[model samples]
Target: MSNLAARLRARRAHTRTRRAVSKAIDTATTTTMRDELITLAQTHGYQKSKPRV
Candidate 1:
Protein backbone atom coordinates (compact mmCIF):
# COMPACT_ATOMS: atom_id res chain seq x y z
CA MET A 1 0.00 0.00 0.00
CA SER A 2 2.76 2.43 0.91
CA ASN A 3 4.65 1.71 -2.29
CA LEU A 4 1.55 2.23 -4.40
CA ALA A 5 0.89 5.52 -2.69
CA ALA A 6 4.44 6.69 -3.27
CA ARG A 7 4.24 5.82 -6.95
CA LEU A 8 1.00 7.70 -7.32
CA ARG A 9 2.46 10.75 -5.61
CA ALA A 10 5.49 10.66 -7.82
CA ARG A 11 3.40 10.38 -10.95
CA ARG A 12 1.29 13.33 -9.93
CA ALA A 13 4.36 15.40 -9.19
CA HIS A 14 5.87 14.53 -12.52
CA THR A 15 2.68 15.52 -14.30
CA ARG A 16 2.62 18.86 -12.54
CA THR A 17 6.24 19.51 -13.43
CA ARG A 18 5.63 18.73 -17.10
CA ARG A 19 2.65 21.05 -17.14
CA ALA A 20 4.71 23.86 -15.64
CA VAL A 21 7.47 23.38 -18.17
CA SER A 22 4.97 23.37 -21.02
CA LYS A 23 3.46 26.62 -19.84
CA ALA A 24 6.85 28.23 -19.48
CA ILE A 25 7.87 27.16 -22.98
CA ASP A 26 4.64 28.53 -24.42
CA THR A 27 5.17 31.84 -22.67
CA ALA A 28 8.73 32.12 -23.87
CA THR A 29 7.78 31.36 -27.43
CA THR A 30 5.02 33.97 -27.42
CA THR A 31 7.32 36.61 -25.95
CA THR A 32 10.02 35.90 -28.51
CA MET A 33 7.55 36.16 -31.39
CA ARG A 34 6.19 39.41 -30.05
CA ASP A 35 9.66 40.85 -29.71
CA GLU A 36 10.57 39.83 -33.26
CA LEU A 37 7.41 41.42 -34.60
CA ILE A 38 8.13 44.65 -32.77
CA THR A 39 11.71 44.71 -33.99
CA LEU A 40 10.60 44.14 -37.54
CA ALA A 41 8.07 46.92 -37.23
CA GLN A 42 10.65 49.31 -35.87
CA THR A 43 13.00 48.58 -38.79
CA HIS A 44 10.56 49.66 -41.45
CA GLY A 45 12.32 52.63 -43.08
CA TYR A 46 13.21 54.15 -46.40
CA GLN A 47 16.88 53.05 -46.47
CA LYS A 48 17.97 50.05 -44.52
CA SER A 49 20.27 47.17 -45.34
CA LYS A 50 19.68 43.62 -44.21
CA PRO A 51 21.73 42.60 -41.21
CA ARG A 52 24.46 40.12 -42.09
CA VAL A 53 25.99 37.77 -39.60
Candidate 2:
Protein backbone atom coordinates (compact mmCIF):
# COMPACT_ATOMS: atom_id res chain seq x y z
CA MET A 1 0.00 0.00 0.00
CA SER A 2 2.74 2.45 0.81
CA ASN A 3 4.56 1.66 -2.40
CA LEU A 4 1.42 2.29 -4.43
CA ALA A 5 0.88 5.61 -2.66
CA ALA A 6 4.43 6.63 -3.36
CA ARG A 7 4.07 5.80 -7.02
CA LEU A 8 0.88 7.82 -7.24
CA ARG A 9 2.53 10.80 -5.60
CA ALA A 10 5.45 10.67 -7.98
CA ARG A 11 3.17 10.42 -10.99
CA ARG A 12 1.16 13.39 -9.82
CA ALA A 13 4.28 15.46 -9.35
CA HIS A 14 5.52 14.55 -12.82
CA THR A 15 2.17 15.47 -14.37
CA ARG A 16 2.16 18.82 -12.64
CA THR A 17 5.68 19.60 -13.76
CA ARG A 18 4.87 18.60 -17.33
CA ARG A 19 1.77 20.81 -17.36
CA ALA A 20 3.73 23.79 -16.10
CA VAL A 21 6.44 23.30 -18.69
CA SER A 22 3.85 22.91 -21.48
CA LYS A 23 2.13 26.11 -20.42
CA ALA A 24 5.40 28.00 -20.36
CA ILE A 25 6.27 26.73 -23.82
CA ASP A 26 2.85 27.73 -25.15
CA THR A 27 3.20 31.22 -23.71
CA ALA A 28 6.64 31.65 -25.16
CA THR A 29 5.46 30.48 -28.61
CA THR A 30 2.53 32.88 -28.54
CA THR A 31 4.74 35.78 -27.54
CA THR A 32 7.25 35.00 -30.27
CA MET A 33 4.52 34.73 -32.93
CA ARG A 34 2.96 37.99 -31.78
CA ASP A 35 6.33 39.74 -31.97
CA GLU A 36 6.92 38.37 -35.44
CA LEU A 37 3.49 39.53 -36.63
CA ILE A 38 4.07 42.98 -35.21
CA THR A 39 7.43 43.20 -36.95
CA LEU A 40 5.92 42.09 -40.23
CA ALA A 41 3.11 44.62 -39.92
CA GLN A 42 5.56 47.38 -39.17
CA THR A 43 7.62 46.46 -42.16
CA HIS A 44 4.49 46.76 -44.29
CA GLY A 45 3.59 50.14 -42.73
CA TYR A 46 0.52 48.73 -41.06
CA GLN A 47 -0.84 50.95 -38.28
CA LYS A 48 -2.83 49.86 -35.29
CA SER A 49 -6.37 51.12 -35.46
CA LYS A 50 -8.18 52.41 -32.41
CA PRO A 51 -11.00 50.27 -31.11
CA ARG A 52 -14.43 51.80 -31.45
CA VAL A 53 -16.35 51.92 -28.23
Most TM-score-accurate candidate: 1
Model 2 segments more than 4 A misplaced: 29-53
* Top model number, lDDT: 2
How far does residue 18 in candidate 2 sit from its true spot (Å)? 0.4
- Residue 6, model 1: lDDT of 100
Clashes per candidate, residues 3 or more apart or on different chains: 0, 0
Error of 1 at 24 (Å): 0.2
Q: What local distance difference test score does each model get?
A: 0.56, 0.60
Q: For model 1, how does the per-residue alpha-carbon lDDT over 1-53 read when each residue is reduced to its tens digit?
A: 99999999998876676555444444655778746544554454212234469
Residue pairs with backbone overlap in model 1? none
Clashing pairs in 2: none
